[model samples]
Target: MSFIGIDLGTSSVKAVLVDDRQRVLATAARELTITRPAPLWSEQAPADWVAATLETLRRLKDTAPEAFRRCAGIGLSGQMHGAVLLDARDEPLRPCILWNDGRATAECAEIETGEPASRAITGNIAMPGFTAPKLLWVRKHEPDIFRRTRKVLLPKAYLRLVLTGDAIEEMSDASGTLWLDTGRRDWSDRMLAATGLDRSHMPALVEGSQAAGRMRPELARELGFDAPPLFAGGAGDNAAGAVGLGAVDPGSSFLSLGTSGVLWRTTAGFEPRAGSAVHAFCHALPGRWHQMSVHLSAAASLSWWSSMSGQSEAALLGELGGQIDRPSPVIFTPYLSGERTPHNDPQLRAGFLGLGHDTDRKAMTRAVLEGVAFAFRDGKEALEDGTSPIGEAMAIGGGARSDTWLAILADVLNLPLRRYRQAEAGAAFGAARLARLACTGESPEAVCAPPSGEADIFRPHPDRAAAYAERHALWRRAAEVSHALR
Candidate 1:
């Protein structure tokens, strides 16, 4: 039996095919567009995600028909916390509000004010990026649409509806909704009521590796499948990425730099650390949980700089290797879309500080990269109060392709970093692994064991790590003053 995993990302949808032996057979992806109708609004047509999923699956089939021939299960992972409302007939009520949209800041505050035990229930801070705030925003602003909404779905779960005609949500993905009780691994009634919703609006809950539904018969035939594929409940991008990197047990950690940067570590038990703004969410695996520290903008900031300066990100980072005497004097705060790890402020904007006459394109580029690295360190510090200590963390994401950035990350965190063969295949690959676990009765430990290939390891430089220790302290204080820009 073979399994397929689809990841509905912020910028694209990726479908990956893997065999029973757990080796990747084929993979496909399709880019998506984000619509910004207002200053802080980011949305995408829910149909776009479906179209991309189908097209990517078609591409995967074309790439390796043999893999699809014996496909047994399909899993879904996606950008977490996007609110997709459906009417009575299951049609979308509006464009899907994405995870990065900050329009619901006021609504987030309202939820916190209304629900006094929010932190205890959700194990997260009230933020605009959460799904419940978007729901509140709709109920207050678009009452007509809100009144007609019958079901609310997350990004990838919407595909589950079209593929299997099932309305289901997995715990790992739903944990970010600000309505889920992280400690209980279920929806919190108080939190849902805070958003003007209840259990009726929520979908059937399942664990990430549990079976959700069977494939829709008509669509299964159209895709030339002999039997209905088992739909495995999937996870959010961060949790799915952890699976892909084999970070499924306690002390297993990874540093992920996607559209956003995440420092995720899996734990054996559910521990809520909302006091420090640390996100404690249900792990994709059952009876397990994870702590997350997020930096809202990572590669997105580099992309922005690449567009602003005429050099490609690769061309700019291509110049940053070799020995460095000291860190760049030009300090850049890569908070283009605000921040989430410690401050949780949605209005903070980035800036370039300590600019000198000698500051050229390379220094500015290094500053941008180092600044994001600093943000990651800030996240690590926030998680310092936790019980677990991360050993060597795996590095995966678009930014991880840059060796200089990885070196900076290792040095700043004072930990070794490992780069694997599947750096580009993040969440989709993990979803496929979850699919395998569901299709077969293999334990997560058996399915997501140690790495097969010899991974390249980068160790921290002692001197640079010491320098960053001091610089990060300054960067921390700067973040406070920089909040004035809000």
Candidate 2:
């Protein structure tokens, strides 16, 4: 049988069809837009998600009709921490408050003050990007909507509601809401109360590899399926990507260089280092957890530079070739959208230091690349403190396409970086694996095995590593300066 995996990303909705042997049969995608009504506020209409998902599925089906018809299970992965508030009739109360929205910064403190055990309970510091804080922001500013709110669902759960008419959530995504008692993998009564909400506002929880519900009959027929397919309780985008890479065992790690950068390492149990802004959340599979360091801008910094310079990302990097001989004379801080890991300061902004008369676009490009690598190094240090070392990491995401960047990252972090076959498939491919496990009742080890082909490895050069070590220290000092400026 074939399985379908759908990912609801910030920029687009993507679907992939995979056969029983875990080979991707077909792929499709539909772009999505974000609305910024005010500064630091991001929103997206719930209807738009539904529309994009349906269109993407249709496109996937068209590409491989036979495989699509034999689909046995459907798995979902989506952007985490979005608050999709629903009313009595289960209709969205307003556009979803996105994960990157910073409008609820003040509410984060309110939660910590109201729930003294919040950090201990949620295993995280109060962050405006979490769902609970967004709800608190709404309660204080948009009281009428808050009063009308009946249920809160993460982005994928909202899509799950539309597909199955069930309000079910899985562990990995729910762990980001700041409502779950992450250690126990369940909703926290105290956490909900602190935000003036309760258990009723939460959905039934399930493990990511379990079956949540079957698709609605009408929806199934509309999608051209012969039967209502079993829906697997999938995962948050990061965790889903881990499953796709088979980084499920403790100490197994990967770094994602998407619009945002993340250094993720799987663990055997809950490990919270909230003081360092490290996110300790449940993994996609049972009995596993993960710690991650996030930098809000990774490839995004390159995107911004590309737009400003009127040059494509590929063109800008092409000028530098596959590697750089030494660190750029100029140092850059990639705080374009503020930062998260190691420094949860959203007010921090990016800057370039030591610009000379000879500083050209190529130098700036190299500095941008090195800046992001330095940020990952910061994350690596934070996770390494008082925990097992991350000896090596697999690289994934759009930025992983850059061999030069990967080489730079290897030198900066001083850890080998591996790029696996089919790395481009990412979270959607992992979601398909989760669907396979749920449908076949197979072990995660068997279903979520890493790709079979030999991986391309990026090793650090000794001389460059020593040079970057000194530059990284200077970069840390510069980051401290940025913090002071903020």
Candidate 3:
């Protein structure tokens, strides 16, 4: 039998076909575009997500026709916290509000005010990027749409609804909504009422590895499958990525450097430290939880600079040659899309300092890399919290491909970074593991093993750690300056 995993990402939709042996036989993807109608608002039409996902699946099937026909389970993973409101007819009421959208700053405070213990209940501070606050924003600014919203789903759950004809969500994704009692792994009525919502508006909840429903028969036939495959309750993208990495054991940790950056660690039990702006949420597997320090921009900063400078990331990175022994004199703040984790300031903006006439493209590029490293260092410190120290972590994401950036990251955080084979497969592969578990009823431990291969470890350069520390202090000062810009 084979399994399929689909990752609905911010910039694209990716689908991977994995056989029973856990090998990824084929993969396909389609790019997606975000609409920013206003300065702080980001959105995407729900139809675009459906279209991209379908096209990617078609491509995957075309690439490996026999494996596609043998697929026994399907799993979904997607960008977390996106608010997709649906009406009585299950039609989108408006474009989906995205995780990076900062239009709900006021509503975040409103949610905290309405539910005084929201932080305790959800195990996460209310942020503009979370799903619940986005709903509150819709209520106040787009009243008619909110009034018509009979159902609310996260990005993947909406996609699941289209595939299975059932509205289902899993613990990992629900934990980001500010309505779930994360410690209890369920929804909190008080948190719902804080946003004037009720259970009726929420999807049926399930563990990420459990079977939620089967794919619709007609859709399965159209895709050339013999029977409708069982659908697994997949996870929020980070949790799904963690699943893919087999980082389920307590104390296991990793860093994700995709569009957003995350320093994640699995926990033995519920651990809430909202005061530090660290996110505590349920893991995809049952009886597991995790903590994360997330920065809204990581590779995104590089992409932005690349676009503005008319230079490809490859060309710009090539200018630096390799890892430098000293820090860039220039310092950059990676708050291009506001920020989260340690700051949670939606109005904070990105900036660069210490630029001189002598500064060239190489210096600026090196600064961009170092600036992101500093941000990850801040996240590392936040995750420390007197316990749960991360001795080393596996690196996974598009940005992790850069040896220079990884070397800088290792030095700045003074921690070892490991790279695995197929790390780039990421969340989609993890979702496929969930699909296999759902179909086979296998123990997560038996199925979610780490990939087979010797790993590459990037050890920090002791000689350069002190210099990076000094530069990190300067970066902190720059971030403080950015806080005042709004």
Candidate 2 is scored at a TM of: 0.98
Candidate 2 residue-wise lDDT, 1-486, digit = tens = 999999999888989999998889999999899898997888999899999999988998899998898899999999999999999999999999998888888999999999999999888998888899999999999999999999999999999999999999999999999999999999999999999999999999999999989999998998999888999999999999999999999888999998889999998999998999999999989999999998889998998889988999999999997778899988999988678888887778888988989899999999999999999999889989986788899999889999999999999999999998786899999999999989999999988877678888999999999999999999888888888887
Question: What tens digits encode model 3's per-residue C-alpha lDDT throughout 262-291?
Answer: 999999899998988999999999999999
Best by TM-score: 3
Candidate 1 Cα lDDT to native = 0.88
Candidate 1 per-residue lDDT, tens place, 345-375, comes to: 7789998988888789888988898899999
Regions more than 4 Å wrong, model 3: none
Candidate 1 to truth, TM: 0.97
lDDT of each: 0.88, 0.92, 0.93
Return whichever of 1 and 2 wins on lDDT.
Answer: 2
Give the better candidate number (1 or 2) by TM-score: 2
How high is each candidate's TM-score?
0.97, 0.98, 0.99
* Per-candidate RMSD, Å: 1.4, 1.1, 0.8
What is candidate 1's CA lDDT for residue 449? 71
